[model samples]
Target chain A: MDILRLIIAGSVDNGKSTLMGRLLYDSKSVMQDQLEAMEKHSRSQAAGCPDLALLTDGLRAEREQGITIDVAYKYFSTTRRKFILADAPGHVQYTRNMVTGCSNSDLAVIMVDARHGLVEQTNRHTLIASMLGVPHLVVAINKMDLVDYAQERFEQITSEFSKLTQGYTFQTLTFIPMCALQGDNVVQPSTHMPWYQGPTLLRFLEQVEVRRHTNLSEARFPVQYVIRQQTSPDYRGYAGKIISGSYRKGDVVRVLPVGMESVISAVEVGGQKVEEACAPRSVVLRLADSVEVKRGDVIVKPDSLPTTTQELEVMLCWLDNKPLLSGNNYLLQLNSSVVQARVGQVAYRVNVTTLRQEPAPEHVAQNDVVKTTLHTDSPLPHDAYTCLRENGGAILIDKTNLATVGACMIQ
Target chain B: MGTHTLDYLEELESEAIHILREVAGQCERPALLFSGGKDSIVLVHLALKAFRPGTFPFPLLHIDTGHNFQETLDFRDQLVERIGERLIVRHVEDTIQAKALTEPSGRFASRNTLQIHTLLDAIQEFSLDACIGGARRDEEKARAKERVFSVRDAAGQWNPNLQRPELWSTYNGRVQKGQHVRVFPISNWTELDVWEYIQREGIEVPALYFAHEREVVEQQGQLMATSGLFPQGAAAAIRRRVRYRTIGDMTCTAAVPSEAATVAAVIQELLATRVSERGATRLDDQLSEAAMEDRKLKGYF
Candidate 1:
């Protein structure tokens, strides 16, 4: 079965956790003993149902404050597919946490309260999800019970959401109206809403086609390590995962940055000889000649070569408390490669609400999304983030504190 | 499909292998924390797949609580010998003796907390910048909030609020002089996923995971093995056919009644069970509501 990684995003009181709990509970994935524990620890229970939100609030501070601060992953499997849900915090100050959750997700579940139509937080989350290239989106207009299960409210909310995502490139956009607390239209269809004619949220998640964005035509393998056998002095193997594309024995390949060409001598996965290996599989390959290949070097097909340059234009999401200024140096870590780099120019900051580029600021603070240029001390092999995310994404690490300060998507 | 697709197990394995390579590529000195349990055993198997044909860059470290089962110890030694990799064993007993620590005395006393002292000491002794553990987020609540590369201070304290944001697959492994990062490659795997992978790969674990006749001390709907260190004064020990869901200090880990002699049978039983792995088998976690979070703050794994 395929595994689906989804993130639930909303404002603080939009019931993201309740939706997750309802999903697990209704699917019967919540064990009996765990349910009993949750009930025993629950301090408040309204409407005679257990406080399902307590199940995801695992930390002490979160339990005390009754809010989610970071991302917490929960796992459950149905007959059709397995799901890995990332419950991200909804507060505006925790946008980095939301970005972290959206980075690897295949789908985004944007939660909205029907009582209040699309708000600024909803727009921000939708924009971040679009920026991160989440293929599918399911906008859940929650709390239908509070809105008297009105069909007009649901339609109004859906219309506003459609207007907000006018120019976004989401592959699939679905809108569902439900009450997560009353178990209506989440796992089971609501008995109160006879006007609605759509699949329940669970049904949509189970049937949605989430394609793996692995590019097989243009192979890109960044060498992570070099293995040289001690007993067999003649054996040298380059070990790494194929970030994109495939490799076969006897195929001629090029090693990047070093500019050496060699024929593929052998291919091995998990220590056994294989005829070929594809993207995302960790394998070791032997070159016909010893061409001085080392870690941080990209091995790819000669015809579809990646950009080899020292300057790059990138869209960066600043994640640190310290402000990011121009001409500041940090370590840029790409897939299996790290190089010293400096922030050259802040071109523009994105106005998330309007999806427009504003004037550049002197310093960018935490959770600021900016388009900028980066200069590396050494040549880097990369692709556009829109083309191949695996080869294009990079993170900036602080030089003194060693914290990841920025996430850069190569433009 | 134009692009080649992998099965769910294969995908999880690939993700884990990628994380292992990151540890090898980033950290200068790292160690794989090995136990005789199935999770760490699977870690060893993945390590072989990751760095085989070449020797492992780091050694395997085990913080023995001195309250372990003999079968697990023997299995550890044999596996290390078979792989021909360096094994570093640090004893919590030695730490207790050297530091004049008092052992918890009760019906079910455990050295679970004391093992942290030895683990922290081993890190400083070897100057290990990274320690790859077999912790899965699906196991417990606090771990579910943990990052794949969890950073700890020089004193080995974990401040959940200060956790650095981990985005995508890129991990920041840089740390200060006495600090180290705890990397969990199998963070995404659940208990069922681990068992399914074990069945798929045909990896061997300790014999205790299967059903066997042993004398166990029954208490509070839990069954713990009768060991020398266990104070079994009033509670009667009886022979029962049981199996362990997890492997830990004998004083703390419990067994469940089962007839799962094979991996497939165990996976089948897991699917039909109601209680979670830790909820059904661990004795130490029943101490309080925030037991794991508290232990993590005090440098306990």
Candidate 2:
């Protein structure tokens, strides 16, 4: 079976956790012992029915506050396919957590309450999802039962969501009316809505194709480790997972940043020799000639090499409580390479909800996205985020505290 | 099929190898926690593939509870010898005598909890910057929230609230002095996936995992193997074919009634089993709702 990674994003009280619980419950993924434990805890709290949110709220503090604070991952599989769900918190302050969840996801499910149509939180999440390049979006209009399952309410929300998607880039967009509390159009078709003809949420998820999203036309391999034999001095290999494209045994490749050309003498995966290997496969390649190569070095096809430079223009999202000040030095880590870097200029801050640009901000606060430029101490090989995600995305860590403070996408 | 695609097992193997290589490249001083269990055995296999034709950058560290089954100890020694790697074993008995850690006394008394002190002491003694473990998120609730690279404070305590946001495949391996990170390579794998991989890779495990006719005694509705440290009483021991799903201290690990003598049969049984691997075999986890969480907070692997 194949695995589909997805993120659930929404505002507070939009029933994100409830929808997850219903999916697991309806699919029979919840085991007997886990259900019993939830039941026992519910009775102690005098809750008549088991709180579905308790299923995803694994932390004690989350249960106490009745809200999710961190990204909680859940796994379940049906006969058709398997799923890895990242449940992101909904509060405005936790936007960084949502970004963390969406970074690796192939799809995003945005929930909105039907009674209060479109809100700022919805706009913010949708924009972030687009910025992260999430290919698929499912705008689930939740709590339809509260609105008497009215067709007008669902259409109004969908039309409003359409207005927001006018400037965003999404490969696929879907809208579904759901009542997570009552299990309406979540796992099974809702009898109450005869006018709406669409697949249930579970059905859409099961049938969605998780195609390879990595760049396959240009071969890129970042050397993670060097394997050398002590007794036999002739044995040497460069081991890493291929980020994009394919490599064959006799292909000529160039070592990046140093620009040394070498021929691939052999390719091996799991200790067996293979003629060819492709993206996402961890393998070791033996070069015909001895060349100086180590970790943080990229090996790519000579014709499709990435740009190597010390100056970078990027769109960065501030992730730490400490404000990012211009001219402050930080560590820029991309792929396996780490180097000293400083923020050069703050171009503008983009208002995620209103889509307005504020020029010349003094400092970027937490959860704020800005367009900026950076100067690195050393030159590094990178691609535009619009071209290749693996080579374009990077994170900035504080030199003093070693905390990941910002996420940058090379523009 | 015209397009080349990897199966589920192959994909899982690739991911694990990537994680192991990341630890070797990033961490200054790293060690693999080997317990002679099936999961740890798989981890070792992946480490070998990650850097073959050369010795591992990190050594194997084992915390011996001294209540181990003889089969497990023998298996650990032979595997280390075959791989030609260094092994460091620290005994809980030594820590118990030095630190005056009280041992539980009763029919259900186990030295499992006491192993934490020895593990922490080993981490301090070796100055290991990263400890690679085989813990899976599907095992318990608290484990489900753990990051691929989980950080620990100077005092070896885990604060769930202060966990770093792990995005994409980028792991923040930066740590201060006297601090370390615990890396779980198989955090995304399920129990069934482990068994299937073990079978595919042809990895060797302790004999206790296979069904055998052994003398056993039923206590608190769990079957205890009479072969190891358990004291045999006057009551005649019952002989039944059983297999172990998890291997820990001999006193804490329980056996289930089964006829799975081979790896294929074990996979078949796993498909039909409803209870989780830890739920059926571990007595320590059944103590409370937050049993694993509490142990992890105090630096338990």
Candidate 3:
């Protein structure tokens, strides 16, 4: 079975955690001991129900506050597929945490309450997921039981969400009416909603074709570490992960920034020599001639080379509590390369709630998404994020604290 | 990497290898926190794939609790010798004597907490900037929320609320002069994934993983091997065919009754079990709801 990395987004009390808990519990992922503990904890509360939401609320502060503060990862598997669920916070203040979770997910499971319909949180999450380039969207109109299992309510919510997402692009959009609290249409089909006919959430997740999204035509390999053999002094193997596309043994490759040309004499993946290495595989490449290649260098096929530039336009998400200013100088890291970069210009700030671009502000505060220009000290070989996400993504590190301050998607 | 389409195992392996290399490329003085358990064993194997044909940029560091099984120590030594890598061992007993620390006295008094002190001291002594651990996110609740490159304070304390936002494959391994980072390379792998990888790669583990007849005692619904550390030779002690699900201090790590002797059988057995790896084996986690979180905040691995 393949892997599916998914993120579940919803507003508070929208039953996001309940939906995740139902999926894991019905799939036999929750153990008997955990069930017992949940039961014991449940009895202490007033509701006295099996509080499945407590499972995802791992931290003590979250449990006490009864909300998710950070993105907590949960894992489960079935015979059909393995799942890695990024349970993101629903609060508007934690938008950066949601972006962090949505950055690597293959699909986004967005929750919309049937009663409230598409609220500000729903549109914000959808916009952020779309901005982060999440391929698929699953709009789960949860808590349908409270709506008397009305098909019209589900349709109304779906249409509203569809209209809200009119400007965005998703490869696949699926609508499911689920009562996560009642275990309806989550792991098993719902009996109350007889009018609704659709695959359960688990079934849809298992059958989603997400692996084809990997870019195979544009080969980009960012050199991470250069390995020199002590036994053989002349062996200089470029160790790095093939972020996108593939490289063959005899393929002529070019070292980026330096523009040095060489032929791939050998490709070693997983410690074994292979004729060709594909994307997402950590491999070591042996060049015919020893060129000036080290960490923070890219090796790509000469035919499909990325744009090498010192000036880059990117969509930046401010994560740190400190606002990002125009003159801020942060350490910009793209793949293996790190360069001292300065924020050049803030073009416009995209309002996450309405999905609209407004005038640039003086400073981009926490969780604000803005289009900006960055000037790096050294030239970087990168692709547009829309064309190839692996090579286009970057992060801005705080110079003072060494903390990751912002996330950048090259445009 | 061999086939055009990688299975889940291969994908997980590739991701882990990438993380391993990131630690090597980012940090100047890195070390692999090796315990003789199956998870760390798989970590060592992945490190070999990551930096073979060239020496690893890091050495293996083991924080011994002194309440270990002889079999595990022997296996650790043999593996280090065969791999021809540097192995540094710091004993909790030595730390206790030097610091005049008091040991917890109980039926199964674990040195698990005391080992944290030894680990921090060793890190300071070696000035190691990066410590690559074998912790999996699927192991515990707090661990599920941990980042791949978890940064710690100068005192080696983890601040869960102040974690950095880890985005994409790009990791920020930068640290100040006094701070250090704890990197988990196999954070995505589950317990079953480790066993499956062990079976697939033919990675050697201690014989305690397989079923063997040994003197055992049942305590709090867990089957623990009878050892000198916990001298419970009363009516509760009985000989049973058992195997350890996780290897830690012998005083706290429990065993389960199983007949699986080979790696394939162990995988099959794991597939049939409903209890979690740590829940069924480790006793320290049973103390509180946030046991792991509290321990992590105090610098316990």
- RMSD after CA superposition, every candidate: 1.8, 2.4, 1.8
Stretches of model 3 off by over 4 angstroms after superposition: A43-49, A61-69, B1-3, B231-235
Model 2's CAPRI class is medium
Residues B1-301, candidate 2: write the lDDT tens digits: 1145566677778888988999988999999999999999999999988988778999999999998888999999999999999999999999999999999976668899898899889999999999999999888888888888898878787766557778777778888898899999998888888998889889888889999888888877788887546555554679889999999987988899999999999999987877778878888998888888888888888
Clashing pairs in 3: none
Stretches off by above 4 angstroms in model 2 are A43-49, A61-69, A231-233, B1-3, B227-237
Native-referenced TM-scores of chain A, all candidate models: 0.94, 0.94, 0.95
lDDT of 1: 0.88
Clashes of 1: 0
Interface DockQ of each model? 0.67, 0.56, 0.67
Ranking by lDDT: 3, 1, 2
Comparison by TM-score, 1 against 2, better one: 1
Indicate the DockQ of the complex predicted as candidate 2: 0.56
iRMS per model, in Å, is: 1.8, 2.0, 2.0
- CAPRI class of candidate 1: medium
lDDT for model 3: 0.88
Q: Per-residue alpha-carbon lDDT of model 2 for A229-314, expressed as tens digits?
A: 75645688899988778888999999988999999999998677988888778999889999999998999998898989999999
Q: For residues B1-301, what per-residue lDDT tens digits would candidate 1 score against the true structure?
A: 3366677788789888888888998899999999889999999999999988888988999999988899999999999999999999999999999999898888768899988899999999999999999999988888999898888899998866557777777778888788889999999999999999999999999999999999998877789888778777778999999999999988899999999999999999999999899998898888887888889888877
